[model samples]
Every structure is written in C-alpha cells, then in structure tokens.
Target: MPTSASAFEIQSDFDAIDFAGGMIAEAKRRTGDNAAIEYACADMFDWLARFPEAYDCILTVGTLHHVDLTSALRAMSRALKPGGRLLVLDLVRRPGWRYVLINSIVWDAPASFVDGVNQIS
Candidate 1:
C-alpha cells in the first residue's frame, strides 16, 4: 500500500466500521496525512456489485465467513479489473479433536473473549 493510493474500506456491520475508520485515521496521522482511505458502513455485496471492474486489487481479512462465500467471491471478482489480485485471510473450521479442543479451551475463556470468538465463528 502506497501513501498516495486511494483505498476503500467497507464493512457490512456498523460497529466494525468504527474500528476501520479509527485505523485509517491513525494511519493518516502517523503518515503526516498522506494515506487516502475512505471508510463506509455498507453491505459488501451491494457495494461491490455496483462497481464492475473498478478496482485493481481486493483485500478481505476475517470477513468472508459472515456472509455467503460464493456470492461474495463472485462480487469481489466482478469488482476487480482484469488480472487483478484478490487477497483473503480468514478462519476455517477444523474437524474432530481439533474442534473439540478449541471448544474446550473457549469454554473457559473470559466472557469478553468468548463473545468475540462467537461473533467471528
């Protein structure tokens, strides 16, 4: 990411938008006001569907599991230019003992931590 590049950060959840907005503000502040990022509270599907082939790259972190994965991928692909890159970082479910172990550990976790985990799961 360049200091002069234009970026859009859109989140379907309103609460998540505040976090993104704060991060962008902090980045701009640290970089002496050169980072150009726009934040929005909107559904990714609806927003991405409007801008066909408009973006050179699309990046999604820890968000895909919350919605319809197939549709989300299609929308993201449609919104990107030819040969554009799509970067995704998210959690995947583990089966058997791994799942059991994770559930056991989370059972004893702090209330706040467990709440966060539940939201993502």
Candidate 2:
C-alpha cells in the first residue's frame, strides 16, 4: 500500500491513498490499475490508527518534517508488521563540529547568500 500526506498524481500497479480530494481525482484519471485508489482528507495520526501492525513496509519522503517527529515515529513503529521495513528520505541538520563552524561563519549572511550556498551540489 502507498500512502501520502499530500496528493499524488501518478499511475501505479499497487494500491495508494492520500489526504486530498484533488489528488484522488488526479489518481483516478492517471492510474491504469483496475483497483481504485482509496483516499481520505484526515489527520495522519487518526488515519494511521485505523491499521495496527498491518503493513509490511512503509516509505515516506520529505514528510516527517511537517509533523511531530517523536509522535510520527511512534505511530509508524506501531503500524508496521513484524519484520516490516520503514524507509525515509528527508533533510536533517546535525549538530557537529563542522556544522557549528559553518553556522558561526555564515549565521550572519543574507538569505540570498545562504540560498546560494545551499544550491551547491
């Protein structure tokens, strides 16, 4: 099962759901699968509560930053079946010596400067 806090508009072979009505419509138009995508515009915590230890895998990208980190982690942990895998892709800032040095040097820079630095690959 695929889930998203926001809407998705891509076709896929597996099941998918999101918390947006517009996304649901887009999925209906774009998806080729016979099974209709199920969706709900509800809070993640409440939605997740419906399924306990039900999923074999959970994948999230760039979503954890928008919610309570501890609570989200707990919810995901509870929702996963035994031996389930949870994969996450998101940005994180670590406080280390290098980070401290960079912050000290650039903390006073203008927003444009910071953006420019971040744009570097």
Candidate 3:
C-alpha cells in the first residue's frame, strides 16, 4: 500500500484518521516484509500530476471537503491506471437551507457555497 499526505505527524487531526506517525509505524511493524508500504509527504495534486495513471487504487478519507472537488477528482482520475479504483469515504450533507447555512459557517464560506456535491454524478 502506498500512502501520500502533506504531513505524517501523530497529532490531533492526523491521529483521528489513524494515519499518523505511530499508527503507520505500527502498521508497518505488523505487516513486516510481506507488504510494500510507501509514504510520501507531498501535495496530492502535484504528486498525481507527476505520476499519471500510475496507481491501481487510490483511497481518500475525509479529505475532499477541504479541496476543490472538481480539480481534485480530475487529478485523481488522471492518476488512476486502467481499471483503477478510487475509494472515498467522506461526510455528506443533507440538502436543505439549514444544512447549507451550517456548512457555510463551518467552512467559512457563503450560504450558497457548494463543495463537490454538485460536481459528483
């Protein structure tokens, strides 16, 4: 498995996702030589751009919310090899005025701001 991120510190945010330093080390220890694990601390888009269609699978968890959905998805698609799979686990918001307002405030944007939801499907 190959993992990419902007940082690998075992801190609050990273720890919550189980991708922090300690977790990665523990996983590596458990897997031993049977698994080939690679980690890179680089911008996802830049990394994907440099290695077009290089990966068999790309897994993203709780990350798209913070990025430009269209751009990120496009990059991920380009980075995927033929018959590749992209598994994304993310939070979904219900469609409504209240939810929109909440998302705007939580994300620090306008009430009409849409992030990736409209772009999908």
Best by TM-score: 2
TM-score (C-alpha, index-matched) for candidate 2: 0.54
User: Could you tell me which residue pairs clash in candidate 1?
Assistant: none
lDDT of 2 by residue, 4-118 (tens): 7444754543335555678667767786555644545566677668888776666655555566555665676666666666666655465544334233321232223322333
lDDT of 2: 0.56
Give the clash total for candidate 2: 0
Which stretches in model 2 have alpha-carbon errors above 4 Å?
A: 1-15, 91-121
lDDT of 3 by residue, 9-86 (tens): 343211112325675566557767542356544567777788787766666766666666667767877766766666
Candidate 1 residue spans exceeding 4 A from truth: 1-35, 94-121
- Of the two candidates 1 and 3, the one with more favorable lDDT, higher being better, is 3
Give the per-residue lDDT of model 1 (tens digit) for 37-82.
5555567777787788776666666665566555666677777676
Error of 3 at 67 (Å): 0.6
RMSD of each: 12.9, 14.4, 12.8
Candidate 3 weakest lDDT stretch, 10 residues: 10-19
> Each prediction's TM-score against the native?
0.52, 0.54, 0.51
